[model samples]
Target chain A: MSATTAVPTTAGRRPMRGLGALTASEARLFLRDVGSVVFAVLFPALLVVGVGYALPGMRDPIEGMGAPWDGHLAIQLYIPIALSLAVATVALSTLPTQIVTARELGVLRRISTTPMRPQGVLIAQVVVNLGVLVLASLLALVAAALAFGLPAPQSPAVAALAFLVGAAATAGVGLLIAALVRKASAAGGIGMMVYFPMLFFAGMWTPGPLMPDTVAAIAQFTPLGALSQALTAAWFTGEFPALQLVVMVAYIVVLYPLAAKLFRWQ
Target chain B: MTTVVQVENLRKSYGAKVAVADVSFAVERGEIFGILGRNGAGKTTSVETLAGLRRADGGSVRVLGVDPRKDPQAIRTVVGVQLQEARLPARITVIEALHLFASFYPDPADPEELLGMLGLTEHRGKQFAKLSGGLKQRLSIALALVGNPQVAILDELTTGLDPQARREVWDLVERVRDSGVTIILVTHFMDEAERLCDRLVVIDEGRVVAAGSPAELIRGGNDERTFRMRLPDGAADQFDLIGSLADVHTVIAVEDEVEVTGSTHVLPAVILALAESGIVPDEIRTMTRTLEDVFVDVTGHAPEEELAA
Candidate 1:
């Protein structure tokens, strides 16, 4: 029953002040959230390193061409693939889990109450995930180039385009998963179940084209199949598929907005 | 004063289950209006609609004169919300959480001032998971107020606080109200509602069963008032001496436990007589009817009555 403090009059201002502020705040939160940071950057880099080390001693299906499997070319080939996996893991696992956890924790629920747009929230996730994916991909590439004598890419533009396409496609798929699953535990499982299979099928371990006819046909149609094809063609053969790029772009255009629409803040 | 929040026949249902049915209430500028109900009584659902979290199947809601469904984003900037069920990332530190939430607002309260006000200045650097429940709750409160909002929505404001912590929260809430920020309090604790809210709405089974000031509702129930006395040890016979005094209607005693039922006019006289007799009870308190009693009368249970039953 003590005297109340002075009332401030600040509500006369406009809503949706500026995305820059929100984006900065979200970025800070993402960095402050140590688990998300590791998941986005450190974990993916570790995975790429593990895959690179594990691959050098194994049989290379396309090694007959003397393409130098452990050199920069092979490792550069992994730049896009590693980035793709990183993107998928980030959008699928990190975004969905955060959304679900936000809902459970009432963060989303509270956010829903404010003038903050659901779109802002989605944009924040994409921004954070994109940062993670880019940083992780860079770290992995630098490590591979320095430590294992991984090959540098023949075409930087092709490699960059391929990485962007792969990241967008992965983000779309991740959004779809987040929209469909509202609970953190369920979303985590779905994200892993859906993305890990894509990794194995996308030539992360076994080349997709060398697989049995049935396996190759099925893999070709999956989203990951297109990504693997795009990256493999760009890095290994110096050949980029315009059609595959178009298809990847199409996947992004369709899934990104769809996820945004269905994404619940609460 | 103009109403800061208005709801008309707000309805929300999930599949076949109606979570909130025709719940409507208004909160004036700068008043703490509590929504009192047990769990599953549609308190959360009702607040969600007002906050634009859940789409109401029927009716409409307006906060700061904006339709939440049509302009959820616009509404969010003007109102701060502290949901009962959620938490920030476990790794997030207290000051970090404050800064993060404050970033959403064009003009936000100072994070340092917010921490100081909430008594979280000491734990500003602690990670969210490491904080105690009361500390977490306080952080959430700080987050909700960071936007420098004209209105604040809080669910289960003091559900898990120890007495001292609860008092601290109550003080903070009072401070928020003083800031001219309209508040919507969703809780089942009648005492909390009585102590915090200027007016309240009670819900049961997704329907609003009562709405009024706490005093009016308590008076409307017309419940019998009781005088309770805890006498000193070996003072069992003191009840007999007090029970026979003038205006004392019914004196019931079992061992040292004593309860006197009478009109408000007579209870004080009896207590005064007891004090005059040189046999003062260890603890003497008048039992007035509360919102809890009214809930039981109207909804057939006490505040925590549902869970207890």
Candidate 2:
């Protein structure tokens, strides 16, 4: 028998050399999933067109607001709501379910036995899900703007910041859910359980201004609610919503590390 | 021979159940070593610990001379593992899975060559969920060898395969070993171990009951052979004479046949004694103990019995 005399030397590649390949493969699998595509990519845009443009008088200016705010259409507020829904669909439903399923299938365990760390797969999932969420959000925005003549974000920079922070906070919560649930089906059930309530607070069922005073006050503290408010403020008023940004930042601070600590490779 | 894997006094427990207790074995470089046991006999757990998938409760494990616990990633790079129940994504095609796993290593085997070697070229585009059980097993084996690893740990490699497919997989294993990859095969199939393993350790109830080469273990047990032959209808009186022979250990008459069991010399002596008595045996058969018998003898129970228990 021939014995190996020396260990093979690794070519000085970056530690994360495989991340792009991992993410690309995960992206391919993610696109093939019809349920995930329908909910995360198509559903949000459909909601915007069906709810935003189909409703009469939604395109007209809102009453009782002064100056530039007074003439903005109520349908415009739904754009941010649509974007938040995109984030929620991927982060709450798709991301956690995929992670938990991978764990259950021993996909992560198989990857752990390779030269690459199994965490690389998790990171790849995050990157792919986030990319899908962004693309879905962009599609929603474009579809809404073309169908309903929705205006562009007044503060593009602040809107970008809001989207980044919201995506981080939402995906962090998804990772936490993946960490807590041992079964893939349980992750899906728990994810949808968290999803509907967050969507309700983000004004999916009723516009924020039309909700009762108490409900509106409570909605501002929710992660999706804060994200919706920040995005709306950036899109219409050309200003950053400090309080909403802080709430999202706080969610990231608490959820990210907790998920990391509790995560199980097996 | 250089030791590729050394596991000493390995112990593991899940809650109150001791899955593996006091297991020890050493695998030499370029040899196909085996851990043989029935289901739930801790063979999988022992190999998982060697692959660095599970932390040992009490033991020292060195794979290619590196402590797995201290450097799991380093061990992972050199030791490929085909876990008993692991799988790829349901929608991933066979070629996709191969390419993806290939990217995980710095020096991976050519995916096309690997696919050809495992006879998976035709199924390259088939989704994982659509493959048959035997095909899936072959794919799993191919994935384990894609990294050109120094050591490969395969757990229950042919559990669900039919006889023909099982033989095919065994041939593939032999080819892999011929290429100089040290293999630690975990199996319960006696024939598989007997045919392939250079050395093996038989585990029972979370302990190593016997360890040696198949030939050595079989020889270590009773070397006596049993012989049975048909005598004339009136030869029953000769049973006592055969029993009284110097080399024969025991002699008994069943119906019209006489059964004699003793050392190697007993067979010839019994034949000569029967001839001297004017008895010509029409039928004679000899039974020799195999490794399976040795396993039963040493473990105090058959593998099936241990499994049922």
Candidate 3:
């Protein structure tokens, strides 16, 4: 062999540089899964469109309520509930399953052999899932405003903040579930175990003013419930719901690093 | 030739499991080095240490003159590894996987060139789940070489592949070596080791049982002639003349096997003596000791005793 053909085994490239390509690759993979797309992105809009057209009572003004809550329609309240479902679906159902499946396939181990850290894959996962959650939220909001003659969110910035922190809080829980699972089946099973009950508290079955007073008081303590209340509070009141944001941030603070500590590479 | 990988007295264990009790080898630049052993042997553990996937409980490993334990991060840049049972996501396309892994290196081989070179160009758009075992292996090898490392470690490259696919992968390995990258191949298949390895260490039950080229191991120590034959049902007596020949040393007949051990020219002498008696043996296999026999001779067990893990 000539001197020009001599191999130069480097220590690897810049560590952070691989993240963009990694996220793009993961995004493409995520887009290929029909199950993830249907449940994460389309389901929330389906909830908005289906409920608006199917249940005419939802588009009418909510009755039997007085003061500031009087003018809001049942459909308006269902929109935030649908948004909660959006974040929960991807964060709980899609995120954990994807992570545990990659672990089962030894993707983490394979990535570790490169110059990039395995943590890059985790960061990419978070970024992709969070981006999907945001998209799902906006799709639900836009569908409600365009189809039902609902106005724009009273405070768009506050709504966005609620979406991010709310989605992150739920994603943190999904990471913890992924960290605890050894197989994709187990991830799906455990994610389901945590999913439906959380949705129950988030008022998927009971919109604002429709839920019992005691149930609403109880839902404030749960992650998705806090998210639902936060989004609802941001929309009608046009203010940052400080207590709801704190509750969501608390979940992120406690769950995310714990998931990282417990992450299983293979 | 220069030594790019040097390992000495490597030892690793999971609690009391003792996965690698004692192991060592040196790999020359631009040669395919084999770590030959059966499943449950220390072959995987030893390479895992060299690749910096595992820390040795004892001993030292240096890949490209850098110690893996002290600086595992440094080794990752210099050595590209295709780990046993390691796989890409099922939905990832072949081309996407190559491009994705290429992003991890400062200087990477062209993805298109790697695809064409590995015979995966047509399968570039195929999802990983849709590829055949051979195609998946080709993609795995492409990912390993994508980083343009000086050394590539491929563990169990053809474990689940068919014979034809196995041969194709072996040919690919040779071509890769021809490109000037040193390869460390870990496999349980004796034929794979003999066909591709320039030099190898035979690991058995977490220890080095033998070390040399396949030919050297077959030639064995002291260069003695040993041959085995199978005779007709009642032709055991035919060994009487061949045993007494001037060049012959010993003949042992047991069941269907008639084995002869002797000095030079003994094979031809025995054949000539057998021909004179109007005796024709059903089968005669001469002086050919494959890696299987070498393994048994050293480890006191067949190489296929354990399941392929």
C-alpha DockQ of every model = 0.31, 0.48, 0.45
lDDT per residue (tens digit) for residues B1-309 in model 3? 888889999999999899999998899888999998888898988998888889899998877778788777778877889888887898999999999999887778999999999999999999999999899999999999998989999999988888889889999999999998999999888888899999999998899989999999988774568788887766677766787898889999766788898886778888788878777778987767788888888888887733223
Tens-digit per-residue lDDT, A1-266, candidate 2: 12333344344433655777889999999988888888888988998888866888887888896645677777777888899999899989999999999999999988877777788888899888878887898899889878777787789899999989988898888889999999999999999999999998888877645667777678778888888878878887776799999999999999999998999899
Give the alpha carbon lDDT tens digit for every residue of B1-309 in model 2: 888888999999999999998899999988999999888899998988888888999999988777788767667778889988898899999999989888887788999999999999999999999998889999999899988899999998888788888889999999999989999999988888999999999998899999999989877866677888987666657768888888889888777667789887888898898899888888998866677898888777776532210
TM-score of chain A of each: 0.79, 0.92, 0.90
Off by over 4 Å in 3: A1-12, A152-158, A238-240, B228-240, B252-259, B268-285, B305-309
Instruction: Tell me how candidate 2 scores on lDDT.
Output: 0.86
User: Candidate 1, which CAPRI tier?
Assistant: acceptable
lDDT of 3 at B128: 95
Interface RMSD of 2: 3.3
Clashing pairs in 3: A11-B77
* Candidate 3 local lDDT, residue B208: 95
Model 3 / residue B309 / CA error / Å: 14
Worst 10 residues of 1 chain B by lDDT: B300-309
lDDT for each residue of candidate 1 in A1-266, tens digit (9 for 90 to 100): 11112222335555554456556756776787677677778865676567666667422334543543333334445555666677677767887776666666656555555545556665666677677777887886676667555555566688678777766787678778878786889989998898788876676765523446676556655677667767766666677667667777888888978977886665
TM-score of each: 0.79, 0.93, 0.92
